[model samples]
Target: MTLLDNLLFSLSTTLPILLWLAGGHALKRTNRLSDAFIHDANRLVFTWCLPTLLFLNTARSSIVDSWQGDLIGYAAIFTLASIIVLWLITPLFTTDRSRRGVFVQGAYRGNMGIIGLAMVVNAFGTEVIPLASLYLAFITLIYNLAAIVVLQAGQTRLSPLKLVSQLFRNPLIIGVLLGLLWSITGWDLPGLANSTLQGLADLTLPVALICVGASLQFQSLRNNRYLVMIASGFKLIVIPVLAVGIAYLLGFRAEALGILFLMMASPTAAASFVMARAMTPWGELAAEIIVVTTFFSLLTTTLGLFMLRSLGWV
Candidate 1:
């Protein structure tokens, strides 16, 4: 595909997400979605809908068939590295402990399951979906665990036992674990159960995006604009460049390399805002970063893809 094609593809995947966000904002402006509604909706998305989505994705994928240890390993390592780097450096951006955690989470978490998978399939075709699915499954777990750690650390330190308990108790973590178990055991859900899960899974993205839109406060953006830029810079530019560059050096190429770049380059996960709002007082910071990176990722993702394609790296 030409650079123009890639650019258009990137825009196509992200534009609707932006529109969903805008739709929510419009509802808020018109008094259609109130604060209470948004809050309750976010809780619903995070607690049940998102977990169901995760469970279904992982359960449906044949992890054994699509297993790529090196690819998954690189993704997990770089994800943890990005989190550590951001956790250490985010204090430079703000002294507010909660805001620091939100920054770190925003800077590192990508919307891999949604935007990342869409671009991956478009670039490489359905042949790569299983690999992509496995990647999503493993990385989803990492993102949730790391997000909880950093977000909680911002509030106060906890014992290792307490942290582990917190992580396992999380619905997202449980969803991923149960899904992986189902995948491994080759258990098939009955038709009715499958349909029910599918219905809830389908609700995750749209609801999450709308909640993100409604929660976006101009005052928060105005107050935290600088921090938003910093988080966006890491998420959309620095992290992708560094992660993909390292993968190229490490001898990854073609679809493997392409997937790495696209996943890292996608944008901040909308779930970041939900998790933030649920756990911390800094959901606004997470929402701002998501909005900013998501908007600019259209250009950033295309340019990155074009460069890799031009250089014959992917």
Candidate 2:
């Protein structure tokens, strides 16, 4: 298939899920569902469904021959570069120590776990699965470090070592580590084991998207509109432009270029709120950015695919 055809197919596949999320928001607005219901859905998806999906997707892939160290290096450098940019820009936007962490987190982090991996898998193939796994690992590391620094920026009592320890205990990080070890060791799952994992993994995306829809509060957007827009702009526009330029300068081509663009273009991660809630006082702001950016990302991602194709990078 041509790049435009592939882009259309991918967009079609993604649209239904986006619509489902929008419908959930509509339902919540009409008071058809309670906040508690949305909260529980978010909990179920994050703590159970998403991790299962990540683990099964990573574990089932043939990683012995497919693990690309160079791709991992590119992803790592891209993540670090983005974090540095965020650090420089964060102070300009917020002086509230409590709010700085969320602002910076939303600015720098992309939804690599959900949207990023899905796009890579859709645009490239299972062969890119190891690359996605490696990307997730590096992204997680950078995000955690950035989160800690941002959260503790003005606090004399905060210890970086303590923050690092807390991050290591995060469920998503644990899932990634387990998946990586299983991938590197080439461990085979029996049929039953694989089936159970695949079943759980399959539920992750749809459930997570639905939960995202249900949890979105339009009211919060009204309060933090400027921050949300700025963060989203950085995520969908500036980050991808920088990443693509850097990827080209560094000699990445084809699928690697496509993957890098997709990663950089993804909406803010669903976990950003969780991290903000746990580590900062601006959890509500983080959620607002996630909801707003997710809505806007449909257009940006489509345009990104078209541009990449026209430029013959994909």
Candidate 3:
């Protein structure tokens, strides 16, 4: 597909997510959903809906043909490199040690599960689905580690190992591991099991988007506008450029390169805010980062896609 075609297609698929966010705002304004309701919806989507989607997709994937170890390796390397760059640049944006965690978390964590998957599927095809799943797996693993380190940087009371353990305990991570195991073993889920999973998975994207929209606190954005903008720049500009450069250096090209670039260009993950609220004091900051980055990602992603196409990467 041409760059413009890819951009338009991406925007088409993304419209649903943005619309869902808008719907949430309308619902809240109309008193159809209380703030508590939105909070519960967020928890449900993260802990249940999203995990189900990951598990179903991974379980149904063809292990022999779908497993892309090299792609996973590249994704992991790119994510790690991004985290390091964000860490290095953290001091430039903030001097408050407590807020540093929020800054770094917003800068590096990406919405790989939702935005990345949607973009890859739109630009590529179903064949890229398995690759996206693998990419998500690697990104989730790396993000958890980076999040813990950022969240606990100055907290002497929190052990890194303990934080790591807590991250693994997350249902989404468990689902990923289980799905990988099932795929590797070539086990078919029973009809009942598949139905249950599919049902739960169906709720993942839309509900998550709605909750994300409703959870957006305008107050947070007003309070931390500069930090939000910095986070957006890191997510949309810095990361994509770094990922493309790294992919080129590693001899990656064509669709693989394009996919990696889009993945890196995605906005801050919704899970980052959830994790922050559950484990740290920077959750609101993370939410602001997500909102600002997501809004700007439309432009940055289009520009990245155009550049990738011009360079014959897609």
lDDT of 1 by residue, 137-196 (tens): 999999999999999999989999999999999999999999999999988888999999
Q: Could you tell me how far off, in angstroms, the CA of residue 99 lies in candidate 1 after the best superposition?
A: 0.9
Evaluation by TM-score, superior candidate among 1 and 2: 1
Sorted on lDDT, best first, the list reads 1, 3, 2
For every model shown, what is its TM-score relative to the native structure?
0.98, 0.84, 0.89
Candidate 2's residue-wise lDDT over 1-314, tens digit each?
A: 46566557556645665687788677877899886876676666656666676566566656656567776777777777777777677778766556766877787787887778888888888777776766676566567557656766634355767867866776666666677678778778789988877887777666566655766667777877878888888888888898888778888889978888888888887667655654555667887787777767777887888788888878
Clashing pairs in 1: none
Per residue, candidate 3 scores C-alpha lDDT tens digits across 238-280 of 8789778877888888778878888888888877776666566
Give me the displacement of residue 277 in model 2, in angstroms.
4.6
Error of 2 at 211 (Å): 3.5
| RMSD list, candidates in order | 0.9, 3.0, 2.4
